[model samples]
Target: MPSLRHELLAYAVPRVRRSRELDDAERERGRLERWHSGLDRSLPTRLVRHLHQRYEVEVDRTGDFPTHVLTPRTHDVEATVVWMHGGGFVAPIDAFHVRYADRLAQQLRARVVLPDYPLAPEHTWADSHDALVEITARWTASGPTLLGGDSAGGGIAVAVAQSLRDRGHEQATGMLLLAPWVDLTTSTPSTAWFNARDPWLHLGKLKAYAEWWAGSPEDLARPEVSPALADLAGLPPALMFCGTRDLLLPGCRLLAGRAAEAGWPLRYVEEPGLIHVYPLLPAIPEAARAWRTTEGFLGRSFG
Candidate 1:
């Protein structure tokens, strides 16, 4: 059973952010406008203030997008974490993502780099994949590095890891995936059932977002777009979390099964009746427990 707060949030978040009744093109245009206007990528003022006061916040603008590096004021960094923020490949990084990354940096004594990746409708996965792979590779070269993300970002993390392996680049020491949207095809047999039960995700909306991110119908099955369909061998050890109520659970299970078959060391945790990305939720018992599990995993992996 989930905590009361979890249950309440599960019901409320969907209502607050659910897709409006509009055609796919209209939604795409609206999102592109938001991206072009720069409103979509803006960090919350409160979060920015908090980061400056508590941590060393540095921004690197050399890449296609700005990467924000957050380092704890008092802790010596044990590792580097290149964390991707999730927005279904369409929305921009939310405050919750920065907060979650900050929490991880503090708990793990790591430097967290949050990349502001290009969003969809205006940009496809190809626009950012190689750049992200290079960024991740550079970080992994320095020290023990972990790649992590939630939702669509998790899918990107897995794809980047696979690219690193194929290219013989320095691989991340570990991966942390939270409710990853690994299969853009969204063809998992249980996905439709879970979509109906999921309060925050709609299969129809996700399919549209997938098409936008993939850039074509055929590309939807590409490993870069649908990592669950990719070969899972020779990747770094990974910790994955999913909630039974999430539409992405079937894909998570698919990836976990494939990981096992490929001898990939993956720790998968499934929480019943909780919402998507439960580990990233703030002030919830479930999130706290999930963070503890993550901390333990990082400790062992970094050792």
Candidate 2:
């Protein structure tokens, strides 16, 4: 059963910030203007302030965009995590993303790398894919490194891992995916049913976002854009979580099914009646339990 807090968030978030408006905008001009007009790509001020007090934060400019590295001030680093922030492929990183990364660093004693990758309409997956593959390869060369993200970011993580394997580069030790939007086509038969129940995601907006990120209808099914359709063989162990209330649930299920057939080591956890990225939400019992599950997965993977 969903908690009261979860229920409240599911109700309140949609009312305050609706994506239908974005969906209804003119496809090219209006959508692009609205997306980039007042976009602030920097990390949240509150998150930066908190990181300064408790962790060592450094900015890496070696990539196409900035990647923030956070290490605990009081603990030795046990591993490294490359965490991608989720925003349906357009939104910037928010406080919740950094906060969750910080919690991972503290609890797992890991160095967390948060990449501010370029978003869509202005940039496509091609722009950032090679850079992320290089970054993951560099991290894995030193020690065990995990690739992780939620929503669109999770899809990027999977694509990066695939690229690494195909290129014969050092692969990430594991992956942690949260409600990943792996299929840009949004063609899953069950997705329409889930879309009706999802409070935050709109099917029409998701298609628009997909077209923007993919750059064309022809590229929508490309493995880099729709990783669930990619060959899952030879990838590292992965832990994935999704909720029934998310439109992305069917895509995650598709990835899991493919992983099984390809002999990929993937453990998928599906929560009934939970909202998108339920594990990342604060002040919820379900999120706490998800964190514990994450800790356990990290322990096994790092060993």
Q: Give the TM-score of candidate 2.
A: 0.94
- Least well predicted 10-residue stretch by lDDT in candidate 2: 20-29
User: What digit string (tens of lDDT, one per residue) describes model 2 on residues 7-90?
Assistant: 998898778666453436356446666877788766674753567867777889998899888777877778888898899888
Q: Which pairs in model 2 have colliding backbones? A: none
Cα error, candidate 1, residue 172 (Å) = 0.8
| Candidate topping lDDT | 1
Q: How accurate is candidate 1 locally (lDDT)?
A: 0.87
Q: Any idea what lDDT model 2 has?
A: 0.86
- Estimate every model's Cα lDDT from 0 to 1: 0.87, 0.86
Question: What is the alpha-carbon RMSD of candidate 2 to the true structure?
Answer: 1.8
Candidate 1 residues lying further than 4 Å off, grouped into runs, are: 19-23, 31-42, 45-49
Q: In model 1, which range of ten residues has the least summed lDDT? A: 40-49
TM-score of each: 0.94, 0.94
